[model samples]
Target chain A: MTAHATPDDVKKLAALARLTVSEEELPAFVAEFEAILGYVGQLETLDIAAGSDILPYANTFRTEGTPHEKGVWTPDIVKAFPNREGDALSVKQIIAND
Target chain B: MESNLASLTITEAARKLRAKECTVRELWGACHAAAKTDAVHAYLEVFDADDAAIDAAQARIDAEGENASVLCGIPLAIKDNILIKGKVASAASEMLEHYEATYDATAIKKLRNAGALFLGRTNMDEFALGGSTENSAFGPTTNPHDTDRVAGGTSGGSAAAVAAHTAIASLGSDTGGSVRNPASYCGVVGFKPTYGSISRSGLIAAASSFDQIGPITKTVADAKALFDVLRGTDVLDSSTAPEGSYPEFTHEVKTIGVPRSLLEQGLDPYVVQAFNTALEATGCKIVDIEIPSNKPALAAYYIINFAEVSTNLSRLDGIRYGHAARGETLLDDYLLSRTEGFGKETKRRILLGTFVLSAGYIDAYYRKAVAARSALIREFDEAFKTVDVIATPTMPTPAFKIGEKSDPLSLYLEDVFTVTANLTGMPAISVPMGTVDREGTKLPIGIQFTAPRGADERVFTIAAAVTGEQLY
Candidate 1:
């Protein structure tokens, strides 16, 4: 599609990213990012194989497990943080006190 | 002569240090003093442990002489996302506020070994998720040019620090235009090498595939100087492109291409005039061309980026290393920890990324974005086929007000010109073009130069060419 990624797209993207998109934010995202997508989309049909004969992107990242080793928690690394309160780090309560 | 090292590049700094013009300690101290006065919050922590870093650098310079490293004794600010051994890398988030880095990032090791003095860690958007450093849990970094405005972030603090002369070069990670956007805003040189060109180990990555750590400096030459110290394969980032054999930068400037589609955009009128003026001054042929698949660039960026962010951030379970909460059950602990450690923006992105990467909806968002990303790269390859390099306004508009953009998506538009290269994994840079009216104030605008695959050095060459039009 010649059309750019729009706010409806951003909202869908937000939903895909698991973010809660507010109603107030919808219009601005549409206006601002649609223009941005238009700028970026300008490259849609540049023929890359013709010259320098190179592929534009590289897919060589070493995918290692941030190694989510499922196991019980050890205190040594956790101790590095300054405040830990009863099996949890002591921090101010988030959200609101309503 | 007493060393006038503050304004010196890493190259000059090394020469002066070797000539014994001044000791590394003196240089380090001076950088610290200058950085201390910057109220922009460029630095998260300025190490007084300066003596050790200095002594280590001096020992190397004393042994290896000028060969000590490409960055010997040059003071640098690291964006908070990268790890520094024994130092806290907050990534400008409250979660890791008190958490100290367990190891040094591979790039940090390379530069440190080369004798670059660590100035301190700079502020960034919390978890490297936002466009504006405004999302930082700590505070927003004011533009060095105009304090009332933003620094063009997640790397805004790093860019501002370099522009303000607080540090000569700063390391910033560019994922979806974090580095180049801020570089353009702060009127400094921000270069993002091709994806996988620079090592990513030790960086608290926001999106794994797109993140690249590059230099944010005052000039293209400085960026090149730092790049030599930074670009290399590393064991930590086992995923680095197999030592992509690329040539050094060329001094000559010739045929450059500009996409008509990109040129005709929502850019401020003054910026448009300035971009054309800079191109005219380049004395190089301004061959107008078409690069299709460019417009969907930003939407594709948010998609692929947030999709990756969803999967990548899943590691921050508040269990292993990040923020953890105390609760009777594990579920409660996970919920409490995330809510406490993450800022509003980080949480928002995490949610967004997670949703996009989810099972049923994957094809609708993530797949389409990835396909679009490939299409964009193909488009860039095609353009580079015809032209040596591509040029565009680094940003459509100059740096906006601190709170002007309330919706996160609107702020993402600031990356309009820079994200195409990021999406395609092509090398791109933001060089100072000229000033534009920034809400009634004069602000710097950047002209972006992008080169073909493995043409990182070429991007620098073209930037140098553009910069020569009105070299400072």
Candidate 2:
């Protein structure tokens, strides 16, 4: 594991997280990240021999229920959309032009 | 006139309403007036009294008489994260600044059925990420007692409203002491019930496994009354525990455990003294106990918190709802919207979460945190075999001056004592212990009591005993 997060590492992580950390904020972000990492790094010393049983999964099933009436929430949902085109949400194009 | 009405506890207010000493509108008026002059800035919006809800509550009280729920006609402040259909539930973040809830949170629905009045949504750390409300996209909620001091948070506004008498009680979600920290700092009672005891449906997601909608109120009984109404299984939230999900806690608290080793350092003298006094007043046997994994519990808690936050917040991609920004490319839209939408602390946590959960680092960080969490839970389970409950100073010190803990690590350290309950999914409550003096001002601190999972009633009983309040 890396000992500390550098400014570059923070910038990369920001990009991955879909956040944009400005160049000016990178140093401070890196410093805070390193501090937090150091703090949580205490867990690295903990022996997990008795604790490795972490994923305790249980299947919970629910009875089928009638769905909400169509269009009941559509207006509110569509209204909250930042950009709407008629009845549908509008977004920037994702397909590449041939 | 309204101030006196505002100051009455929920039980007292209910009794008075029953006796026809005050009208429902009058209580609302009192609280509204308090909110109007509130220097604490607890509420993001102090809604104009819901005339219909007030009328309905009064009609219920008039018809049911003594059979009315104690919360009937009570004015309650809601944390911004809990949805109230047709009302804004921003989680105090800019991303959802104008986002109105399309449906009521399960807790809000329960409270509405009981005829509780919604005063307004209170401020919090944006998306409930920080220990202090200063991280709010709006502004920080100052301690009601001392305007210069911070009301500890992510639930700072909820606690502040209750403490400031702007609301009879409030609901705040606790992931890691979000409710109790503010309650402790503001000198009120904050309770985090067993993780699944209260349905999480409609409450905005933070750390799903750790989050529980809890009550911040003037007294422990008020908290219990609210909790009783809010806790139950829900079809929408599969994580909610069914009735009898865990073994019942039948006996009164007989033995209380003190993790004295953890308390040996970093506690204010006032907090140390108040905790001891509160425990002694309970008249329960106190014994030293050790949970070795607790040493690394905060670290584990934050790791899990970051991971969950990153996952939960991904839903806000600026496509369907909430804040959106235009960018040349689709990927840039997500980045631009998020960067402009979230505050610094939120972005920091998101990055940390991404790092921990990233492919190369997942095993080193995420897996380790999960394992450590399991060990901590097991350790707590072992401790409960011998003790009826555990006690600690809710905060290491009284409310610090606003901006005192600018360093994120220092702020995170304030949560060291409270994160254990969230991590282990145990029930915990912070009752006003007493106050400590700083700069000639008295600041409140709290004594926290934690019980085994599903032993929620046990903590209330002990807390009532300590606070000298009647359990009823």
Candidate 3:
């Protein structure tokens, strides 16, 4: 009763999540993924009729029109970064030049 | 009464402090001596024995006279996931091995103001992922009772510390029974308040929606005292409701709803016998209520857990903080860092999370789980109209041997009885009912009580009754 995740599927997932998986670890991860997915797949058998929302209710704490404020990052916290330049965290460029 | 200072509950310790029968220094000394040992591997780091906090508490007691807070001068163990400013706050993972907290969590700040002294950071499941402390980057914390068994996880160290009398009480974060499960295994009181009852400002996020910082103590009274001190709205946490947001639960508990259907599989006979005996002792009406969503609650809980964990842990990309690895490109940096930093369970969850939340599968897996979750909430709301609390054995079985249940799925199934409360956002507590024997050694199991949202008082009341102690 398992719709198993293939080795290729595992590789794709590892890449998507920015995690490296070695050849030795791939099979174990695949087996675990298959087991977990098959187990959680029981939700598919649950029939929720149409017109019923998945997220039906919000708690009392969820208030509308609450103004949000930007959080300020303290310098001490910024300095904790591995690649810091002049009190700012330095990161490699994300843009691609084709 | 036990003369051993380490064995004193928080209430008793506070009373002793008030009467000047035991100085805070002596209390700290006893707990410190207990903390110094690594026999159970309970502590990741025990703070320096000579701490100024003891002196500070004494000074405050001298000034305030009879007005000191109940937690004043109490030595407590803290889970590694909660941040204590300027101290190393690894979630028992190599990812944050050298990471130091820049500020105290809201809970820690409140405890500090209450004059509670932190003994040290205790070990836990790496990023609170697994049910057993065996996932801890440091070695697993063995059960204090048997020493050959586990002390439950991800709050294993905190529970073990309290059980072993290393600290009068300890604070643990429960995402999915992290606090309660360990509390059951350790034979102590562990409480998980309704979600958002306590501020989550300083806890390292696991499953954001389900995580709560709570207390593990020797008695329900002690747990209640810590919960009172810790529960409140914080501007730092948006999910928290203002103080007194939910009307106080004044309804007396006379009926307990037990979902008989959910107990059909996996529950141990010994635990069932203990639960039945406890139920008889309570003399409260046992109503066999059906929570239809209970069937899928575990599945839904894990789906939500994985999805949230995938998102929450995405921030540990090595550039801003945590252990970093030099690589040719930015992608490589993240991949290499996370690959080396995370444990086996953490990586597996992250992968499954990525799968369920992926493009083609979101609607089928994640969305359906949410619907199941809603169904669960509705069923619970309906059930609470008749019963004030729901009762179950905290775990399906007693504490397994240290290396038992090697399979991840088997480990996840252990959370079956405890995860429903987290899923429905209800308050639950694990109170030690009695011990059940495993082999030749006797292992303790707890009875869990789940109350409606914001009905924390009801949960405590029933729990106090079950434990045969008056709490507050």
Candidate 4:
């Protein structure tokens, strides 16, 4: 797995992570991925059981209850948005025109 | 006068404040003045002492006398990752560099209620990703002992501030050695309480399960003082343990476990010698113990770190808040913002995280790491049955020269000893053992004591014994 990581694999990983790696930086990143993956790959040698639990505890869900007031934080939250109009946050359109 | 005042421990400062020997304004003035001459770049921002907060603390002391909280009027530094309402909680990253925290972190609220003064927000690894704060967007925090060397990080600034006497104490969030690593490098005391002992509601997440807010102070007693104020359950962070979630160790620490195999290689000769000296000084029976899982602990820890960091940081997509970049498409927006906002180390972790959790590879990497985690925890549990505490060199080597470790894996390997406590959700402390010379300069090293989960007090008890300090 360490030697197998290529520039293309890193490009795909960067895309999956929503990060951009420039052409000049791809080789260095791929090299780093190989080195890191090789190091972490040592875990493959461990004789873990077939059905060990990942976490010590089960998933925890907060009890269903009354939510905080709707507009109490709206103004403050809206103030942090990068692009906003009135109280609504704006983003680049995702839908294609027919 | 200011330097001497700045050097006072939290307990000493509190005593002075109570005796009316120094006003809250004077204490803040001493710390603020020291912070202004910070050659190590320990602070991201040294806040102007809030007049109301000062007057309020002074008033409390004047009105309540000895009844006032011991922390009242004591100046402390906060890691940038922890939120303080209306202050910039950047986590030392450009993405959220300008973002102001809308609400106070649970820890901040507790400290405020205790009347602790906020001297500043300290620098750290960007998003707490790197072991050395060289990854900080603002700049690296150099060690106070040696400016050419790094203050071990991602809590580097917090530790450096205390070591330099810029603040009496500071809070640092440790996931894998973040607090203790820096404390070891800077020659101060750092403690990571039992995983859920401290709430994470206001802390910027690095890895969900591993992160625990801890204290960095001049003495073990000071660390204990801050921990007492910070530890507890919080409604906002459900991960916080309820009262008696872990059984208390009622017996005295009579034996210490040494994982001799793990220390046979890679540690500095001086560090090993210092550790041996510190262990003997504990006056506890020493016994050899083997937890083979310790070898793969770093690998497992990093796998989980990448996976969680990738998932946790996904919230910063540039739509609602944080650094934004214009792009033709929505996807393009995310890529551009993240690319421009994050440092190389941060992007590297996020990519590694995505790789491990991606389809087809999840079982091979992420799942395997998870099982390995369980195995490691079980091994620690088994080891603890025979020993009350485990002793090790807090770091493999003392603070390395700045730019010394250019490779990322090298830095990850430095966390070999400290990550085990986080992996097992146990409490650990690093006490300054002694100094080891690096060339003409004498660099400080630390000896770490790890106790069973919920045995946080035991770690402090043993640490105080090793350092010959009275526990608070």
Clash list (residue pairs), candidate 2: none
Model 1 chain B worst lDDT window (10 residues): B1-10
Residue by residue across A1-98, what tens digits does model 3's lDDT show? Answer: 33569999999999999998999998888887878888999988889653454432234444456563544456658868899887778888888898
- CA-based DockQ, model 2: 0.68
- Ten contiguous residues with the weakest lDDT in model 3 chain B: B242-251
| Predictions' DockQ, in order | 0.14, 0.68, 0.52, 0.71
Q: What share of the true interface contacts does candidate 1 keep?
A: 0.16
Q: For model 2, how does the per-residue alpha-carbon lDDT over B95-152 read when each residue is reduced to its tens digit?
A: 9999999999889999999999998899999999999899999999999899998999
> For residues B1-472, could you state the per-residue lDDT of candidate 4 as single tens digits?
7678899999899899888788889989999999988989999999987999999999999999889888998899999999999999999999999999999999999999999989999999999988889999998999999999999999999999999999999999999999999999999999999988888999999999999999999988898888889888777888888776677575378999999999998889989988998888788999999998898888989999999999999998888889999888888889889999999999999999999998877887888888888998899999999999999999999999999899899999999999998898989999999999988999999999999888888988899998888764
TM value for model 2: 0.98
Residue range B48-155, candidate 1, lDDT tens digits: 746777788888888888567657778898999898887888889887887777778888888777767788889889888877799888889999888988898889
The candidates, ranked best first by lDDT, are 4, 2, 3, 1
Report the number of backbone clashes for model 1. 36
TM-score of chain B of 2: 0.99
Listed per prediction, chain B TM-scores read 0.94, 0.99, 0.98, 0.99
DockQ-based CAPRI category assigned to the predicted complex of candidate 1: incorrect
Each candidate: what lDDT?
0.75, 0.90, 0.89, 0.91
Choose 1 or 4, whichever is better by lDDT. 4
TM-score of each: 0.84, 0.98, 0.95, 0.98
